[model samples]
Target: MAAFGQRKAQRLARADASRKGGLDERAAPVVQLLNGRARFCTTSSCSGRLVLAQGSAADANSWEVQKKNCTWLMVTHETCTKDDVMTALEKATGDVVLKFEPFVLHVLCQELQDAQLLAVRSTHCLEVPLSHKGKLMVSEEYIEFLIHVANRKMEENTRRIDRFYKCLEVALKTAISANNSPSQETENRSVYIHRRKRKTIQEQDVHTSLKDHNEELEPEDDTESNLAIFAEIMI
Candidate 1:
């Protein structure tokens, strides 16, 4: 624990090394929220991005644009326009790809339980190999179609990120509340025991209590519907 604390402090104190050289604006709030808790700290993140890159043809997969050999023609954290992608395509020299990368985050958890609590999966994004060896693989209409789909995915990604932030905030608060009250913890344990013994009768009461708790924690914006889709990778 001492070693972990020392390492975390050092990591937090160091300068950001990402390409943009700082925490992404959209993800900063959640990163700060996690770091504020003793049990977790964010190491890296991307709120999501739209990217158009040119890469070497010799790369194992024609569509796989490795950062080492690829040149980024366009990169934006926000939704992009068809003109933006078209302009970027004009600059492509090799294998060119259009991609909508979804929200990604890496966090260091102090314990196994902390990591498990945050385990979830996000929705998939779009990636199309728009050009192969300087030749367009698809029509201009298809490129526009890809852009529209990518933009929609970007919007969905933002909502997923927002949901993740809210869920984590509520979960952390609940954890802290549970830890601070020994009597409440004991009562919860007793409820668990009672439910196991008197399944039918105790289960209904437990369900009612959990429903009430969830209602209390739910945000005014009604983001609870897709709370299960938020993603986090724990290290």
Candidate 2:
């Protein structure tokens, strides 16, 4: 446990080692929230992005475009326009691909249980081959369509990020509440029971008042003639 804490501290100290040299604005809050907890820390994350890159046609098996050999014509974290795509296409010399990368996050948890609390998943990014050997494979209209699709994907990515943040916030709060000391837990339980009893009493009072009101509305039969019949029956 001590070793893990030490390693986590060391890694977090240098967490901002990405090309941007900082955490992405959209992902910063979530990263901070996780890192604030004792059992979890974020290793890396990207809120989502659109990228136009030039890569070799022969490297079809590669999972990612090699940064060393590939050229990044354009990169944006926000939705882009068709003109942006065209401008980026002009710089492509090899196989070019336009990509809409969705929200991704990597978290390191101290225990498997801690990791299991996070169930959010991101959609796989979309990749469209735009150019082959400096020749545009698709028409301008098609590029516009691709841009529209990417923009829509970006909007969905933002929504997912928001949801993930909300769910994680709730899960972390529940975990923390569960870890409270015995005395605190008892106090909380007592408060809850007290509130519940108060509510029940209030409801009962309302019911009694309503019943009384209804009884008052009923016609009262105050006939002395019925008293004589009752006495005769008793006799």
> What do the candidate models score in CA lDDT, each in turn?
0.82, 0.82
Which pairs in model 2 have colliding backbones? none
lDDT assessment of candidate 1: 0.82
**Superposition TM-score, candidate 1 onto the true structure:** 0.76
lDDT of candidate 2 over 1-235, digit per residue (tens)? 8877898999888847676677788998888899998888789988899999898877645535677878789999999999999988998778898998898889888988798898666555798888887889999999999999999999988888888889889988988878777877887677666665665687578769979878543442557535643453344
Those runs of model 1 whose alpha carbons end farther than 4 Å from true positions after fitting are 59-61, 184-235
* Clashes (N, CA, C under 3 Å) per candidate: 0, 0
For every model shown, what is its TM-score relative to the native structure? 0.76, 0.72
- Candidate 1 lDDT, tens digit per residue, 195-230? 445644664676689798785433423353224212
Best by TM-score: 1
RMSD list, candidates in order = 14.4, 18.1
**Model 1: how far is 151 from its true place, Å?**
0.4
Q: How many pairs of residues in model 1 come into backbone collision?
A: 0
